[model samples]
Target chain A: MVKATPLAIDIHNLSLWYGDFQALFEVDLQVKQGLITALIGPSGCGKSTLLRAVNRINERLGDYVRTTGEIHVLDQDILRNDIELAQLRRHVGMVFQRPNPLPLSVRDNVLFAHRIHRADEKFNRRKEDEIVEHALRRVLLWDEVKDHLGREATGLSLEEQQKLCIARLLPIKPTVILMDEPTSALDPKGTAALEELIWELHGDYTILIVTHNMAQAKRASEETAFMLLGRMVEHGLTEQVFLAPREKETADYIEGRYG
Target chain B: MLTERVQLSTSIDLDHRGRDWYTDKAVTFLVFVGGISAIVLIIGIFVFITKEGLGFIAGSLDVREFFGSLAWRPTSPTKPTYGILGLIAGTASVTGLAMVVSVPFSLGAAIFIGEFATGRLRETLKVLVELLAAIPSVVWGFIGLSLLNPLIIDIFDVPVGLGVLNSGIILGLMAAPIMTTIAEDALKAVPDTYREAAEAMGATKWQVIFRVVLPAGRNGLVAAVLLGVGRGFGETMAVLMATGNSIKIPTSPFDSVTALTATIAAELGDAPVGSDHYRALFTLGILLFVVTFIINLTADLVVRRAGRK
Candidate 1:
């Protein structure tokens, strides 16, 4: 079922180790541009670990975590020693499982990433308002929060905060947005709202989401990749993988057997 | 198994107080005593100082003359005029200078320790800062008397080395370790997620610290600074030795002057019991107490505000 679409993310035999214990083993995942791809697995299956590797953010754990092989984003090798991490991160924004808006007003949180990356540019109030309004509108949170734009972002509801987290990344116009269980902390209603927002955002930005919920992977993503025991078991269309799995492990996991 | 269950049920008392209850009660009482002692001692000290100084305040002491005039001659033969305007100025000048010297130094050290250093180096620097805090004020005074005294004199070619400049620098150094400790704790209290989120947005390390962590910890940092100011205000022995104890208002950083704390420290001995001079010294004690109380209260309120947020 190969298509003519160019890949947004191309990973080649990626292996990672935290100190002595390896977390990922020669996993390769190619994510198509302008599509939502979900990585679903049981606990310790290294789904989240694989997502964190795309932007190399897991290295913040210091020199302990070592990575081998290459990760190229939009045809640029991100694993190069001389590459600027700030520039890389600006192009590849992240949304954490728990929504972490900085201790800033809603307006400022939306403008924070933009301001830092474009530090030399001078801006007036109208331009900043446009940027904040544009991003919040994309997340479908503009009308609800427009009146309280000066309110602290943390004071918002969990769903609104999560949407704001995604909005803050939008102003950067990231090539790929990586989300690690973006709905793990939300209630069922909030999760549904966020899934809808993600669906609404497709074709504008490439999305790679990691989730523990198999149903969410089926419901929200066009393509799904299942990992088991730190290895990618299968990658295919969501329907074919869930409805008719080829790998025995994927079939066993989807049917509620031992993980 | 059924018989054992019955026996275990028979020994269990649902409502009875056990060893855990008694231990909890003991700890509660101990904590209450520890907490209340500070309040009680503070009130007791305030009452004692007030009683000692109230007699002079109520009698011939003119409030305007006492606060307005620069004349601090409590021992003038026929007409003793007890004015502390000069002493207040001296203390204010010295403490102000100390804050100027210590605030940036302590804050920079705190940032370095909190955001930059790691592993053994961070641990070692923290231990050293705390050790610096433990050094006796008398030793700091001695350093001012010997080391800074000569250095200041050589630098400015002033006749008197023991003055506001010497003492201010000395007290600033003395207050720095405690300030650094408190400020570092404030920075540490900022959540790590804020830093992670900022870094994920392509912020440099300094940018993350400057924009996010520092602003999040603003209340704690303000409290640390106020605490440092209070420490400088109440410091007696070091200021007494290093400030030259010359009863006059200082016009510049190089002038010799005395602090309110230094005055009380120096004159309380020579003044006879219950004499006006003795009461006047106690009066200075009351002023110092009140000022320090306000400063400490402000600091506590700021920290509590941080807690609420």
Candidate 2:
């Protein structure tokens, strides 16, 4: 077996606690550059928490949280107190499970991210429109939303809202993208569309996804990590893990004996 | 045996009827009393103010002078006069000053408590604000009179602390609790999704508060401000104690003035019935009614619009 080289994000012995409730326990994982890694688990298994930890967004929970060990992103220690969470977040953008576009116009939602992440860039209305249009086009949403660019983003359909959210994140040009059950709230058609977009996005950005759907894990990622009760059950190439999981727990979970 | 059974059946039937019927009647009576009392009181007050003030408003009372005049004196036996311009000006000045003083601080505290403050600190700060709100208005008035009033007088001058400025400062102290609490509620009412969305785009905390949270809470904050303005405008004892209660237009924060509520409280006593002086006090009541009604109505409109979004 040939392992990948130069991990984009390296997590070492990471443990997390929300007050007395431990969420992640001594979990170690590596995500390679320009590839998708899926963290799959049953509900309450801390897949989302582990994904949030990679970008240090878990710190937003405040003092109730206690995290130990290190998270390295591009050879930099992301867990260090000195790390700028906002800047790190800009580099590692997130897309939530629900479609959460701003209250502003669709055009403004896309421009807002660009304005925040790239403040030094000159404020040109036309240039902003171009950037927004390009992002919308990248998500295959431009044809649907182009005429209604000035409409409130909340007015969009659920699928369009999710696509708009994706467009909003793209303008920042983040190197890594974290998604927490991105299509869990969508219908079959919307979910299929989002899956295709995720596949396309894999070549340009390192993606870390947390999902409860086993089929989605098989379809969307190259590597898979299975977790159970705050512990890593198995982690390996997607096909190998699904076909011949090394651990008994992994085998049981894959075979639908228990989660 | 038949007679005994019939007597027993009649007695049981009477007992059941009496108890159940009486209970239902008592409940209905109580609810009716409470509901009717509230509606009657509200309508009664409105009718009384409008009826008493209408005659004076219709006869010889110049609306322009009443609103725009610089002097307000409705207490002269020989040459009686009545004009609300000074009181109106005073109300505007005090409320404006209070809003200016309270708005920024209240918004900052709201954002801090709602967005930035974490865990125990957030809880502590919230408790402190609630305690501040719990303090009685008269107690606040007394504190302002004894402590804040004198402190300002000594620091700035007697005139500066005993006028519109003093009234405004006292009202600001009173308004701060309402502003912070309501603003905090408004900020919290903004969905977590908005914050998450903003953060995901790498927006700073300040940027998120200003651009997203504040705008989203615009209507609620406006309602908060209107409520605060109503409280400031209608406050009697605090303004009466802090303001020197002079019936003159104030030039600056450093001059004494009388608000409509203060004027009515001070002069309603000893004004003979059916006199212009008496009627004018009722007219001041009318003015107060109009001001508060307008403010509350505007607040309702804003809140409705917010709900639509």
* The candidate that achieves the highest TM-score relative to the unseen native structure: 1
Candidate 1 lDDT tens digits, B239-300: 99899988778877889999999999888989999999999988999899999999999999
lDDT of 1 by residue, A1-259 (tens): 6658999999989999999999999999899999999998899999999999998899899999999988999989999999899999999999999999999999999999999987688887899999999999999999999999999999999999999999999988999999999999999999999999999999999999999888899999999999997898899989999999999999999987965
Model 1: runs farther than 4 Å from truth? A1-3, B1-39
Residue A76 lDDT in model 2? Answer: 91
Error of 1 at A16 (Å): 0.7
Off by over 4 Å in 2: A1-5, B1-25, B71-79, B134-150, B157-160
DockQ of each candidate, alpha-carbon based: 0.84, 0.64
Q: What TM-score would you report for chain A in candidate 1?
A: 0.97
In order, the Cα lDDT scores of the candidates are: 0.93, 0.85
User: Weakest 10 consecutive residues, lDDT, candidate 2 chain A?
Assistant: A1-10
* Per-residue alpha-carbon lDDT of candidate 2 for residues B1-309, written as tens digits (9 for 90 to 100): 365553345434444567779899999999999999999999999998878888788885877777777656566656655667778877788889988888877888888999888778999999999898778878867876788777887998564567777778888878888889988888888898898788767788888988898988999899888888888888888888888787777777878887889888887887777677778888889878888999989988987888788
Q: TM-score for candidate 2, please give it.
A: 0.90
TM-score of chain B of 2: 0.87
